[model samples]
Target: MNKIFEESNQVALIVNEFGRFDVDSHIMNQTALSVSMLQGCICCDLQDDLVMQLHQLSKQEVQHVVIEATGIANPIELLSACQDPIISNVYEAPLVITIVDSKRLLQNENTEATETLMDDQIRASHRLILNKIDLLNSDEARQEVIQYVSQLAPYSQIDLAIYGEVKESVKHGQATIDKVNLSTSHPHTHYEVLSYDFTHPISHEQLVQFILNMPDSILRMKGYVQFREFPNEIYLLQYSGGLPALESMGDMKLPTTVVLIGEKLDKPALKNKLELLQFG
Candidate 1:
């Protein structure tokens, strides 16, 4: 096996042959180095030459490759071109984290796609990143990034960092080692959790309409909904870009209140929409 490390790019790419893919040593080292993005997945739609390139690199020894595609259809092509490539079992996979700080420059639509691509970089498992906090001019902007990331990646872990670097408290894979127990440190500010309540039965159509037409200011939307026909029952709705409704068993007495938190949600406008829903 060959290992290729380049300080100029701060990346290592690993390649492996089918017969001798070293799982343990290779991946552990990859994690210890730079933030990595793994691209080969048997269940995914990756190209074969890209796979062979990655295989040859593994045989030679490179660990990670950089991919910044604008119009490229094959996302895995960039990953397959690294030096001594290492193979992983994936079940005990190392985390692939992308650190970003948009400070309102990144559009809401772009935020979802950027995160989706980062998560897609590793198919079998989720990917995480620390949205740099200090870069934002205000505390509110930092919190907005956090809320947006949470909705975009409900299953993945997120850490808050400041001044354009990952925090020492949550470096490498330490934050997501167990995933369920991950937490962020509030070095400069405290975040408050807000809840909006409702006292009426919500219809599926109404709920869908509200989400589809939610203002650009809202970053996250989640809560339970109940239609009159399904009384004494409730359906949970979680949405980022689209919608996923899960059947849930509960008192169904709660309103279809969606707690929307973001950087730009005009409370008065949102309140008007909610008030209308209550009477309708």
Candidate 2:
């Protein structure tokens, strides 16, 4: 979505509690315009907040608006909330895009509930992007992912991406939606998000080690950091499916915070380990 935001000169409203470090990084480089954070998940706590944001954006000269939902969010609930009488006249959802981690899907331990959740996401998407293809070792391995996703969402157009980057043509095109069937009954899946703020600088080596030893229940983590050794520069850390990527953000004025989203997280144990990285 950051790629789309960079390509399209439009306003963006990111809905995340721990500050959208991914969107913030793009805003720092001025590739995006007027990015706003709603500070809660749109699927549950912040539906009204989303309406307010849309109403505010309606007054701006923005041609387009993008709402980046949380990983565990049900997009249908988000869309239904958008239809509220308050902002329905002002904003219309023209497209919905779902980006799938190809590697994660292949490696996921499939339970009945997990399968349902995955299918719901794919079935609701207008455009499906199979991302992290670079992680696949061979052409056959990549094709296997495509085949599996095709069975789930055969109607939607599939595009392969590497490093979360999609082609400009695919980014701008409209998806052909055969139907809009919103499921009334959805299985309740509890996902907890934990946000940590560290004012004191942390050791880069220690941070890497912490991430390496992260619990398997922690599905995704992203945030900005000010390492003691690289105090002059801020780094962005993103971990998904056991793969961690850290990038230098040059010099930027952003908070040093991390947001962890997962199921059955051991918050107390995790907090104790994170405290060890803090400077004395």
Candidate 3:
């Protein structure tokens, strides 16, 4: 969800499966005030509570509402909740957009439980956006994936997205939660989650290229970027899948910082690259 709409200022209803602490990682990427974290399964355990939250949000001055569910929560159930009489009266019919990471799906990168749920999501989706098709080696491979995913989501309207640029029903990364406390111990057995603060301004073109040609291993990145082009202003930079977006923040200034989450990341090497962007 953050991968697609992290930069938006709209209200977000982020559903969590555990405690409030589970939300710590995502805090850095979002405006805490605009986000309402519901700590439980929105589809099952806390259906009533989810309804209440939606009702409250609808009454407010919010324009759009984004509901992000846990990976295990099925979209069908969530969509069902959106149809609650109270909610439907105020909110428009929710657009259940499913984002498929074609590379990860084809490579079988997910564990069995996650894999099964993801397939089910594709099978029961409305608008399916297949992201990261550019990661495939050739156009033929990408086409095969489109064909395969289309079969699973026969009723779904499919769109080919490189960054998801063109849009998640099923996502595997922690880009949504990049503000994790990086303990000496690997917080995640396979993923290296960490942050770096830019001590100097980097050229806009250089930073843009860095994101465009970012390593495949770096799953997600978010932070403030101070570029030579916009030296007087601060821009927020967010990267996920292959999409990297830079949005201006007017005169608001914070230390140009970056938080990255991914599997098999070399922290030192990443730090070095950012340094080059800043110092060079």
Taken over the whole model, the C-alpha lDDT of each candidate is 0.43, 0.71, 0.64
Cα lDDT of model 1 overall?
A: 0.43
Which of the two, 1 or 2, has more TM-score?
Answer: 2
Best by TM-score: 2
TM-score to true structure, per model: 0.35, 0.83, 0.53
Q: After aligning candidate 2 to the native by TM-score, how far in Å is the CA of 53 from where it should be? A: 2.3
Tens digit of per-residue lDDT, candidate 3, span 48-72: 7788888888877776776666444
User: Clashes in each model (backbone N, CA, C under 3 Å)?
Assistant: 23, 0, 2
Position 179, candidate 2: lDDT:
60
> What stretches of model 1 exceed 4 Å from their correct place?
1-194, 250-256
Shift in Å, residue 46, candidate 2? 1.9
Candidate with best lDDT = 2
Per-residue lDDT, model 3, residue 64, is 77
What residue runs in model 3 are displaced by over 4 Å at the alpha carbon? Answer: 1-33, 167-280
lDDT for model 3 comes to 0.64
| Cα RMSDs, all models | 19.1, 3.5, 9.9
Query: What is candidate 1's lDDT per residue for 1-280, written digit by digit as tens?
Result: 1233424333544332211112222223434333222232221233345445444444433344433221112123232322214333311334434454444324455444434443343221234455445556776776666666565455555556654344633212333333322222111111111245667765556666777787654544555566666778766555443333455646734445454534434777777776666566
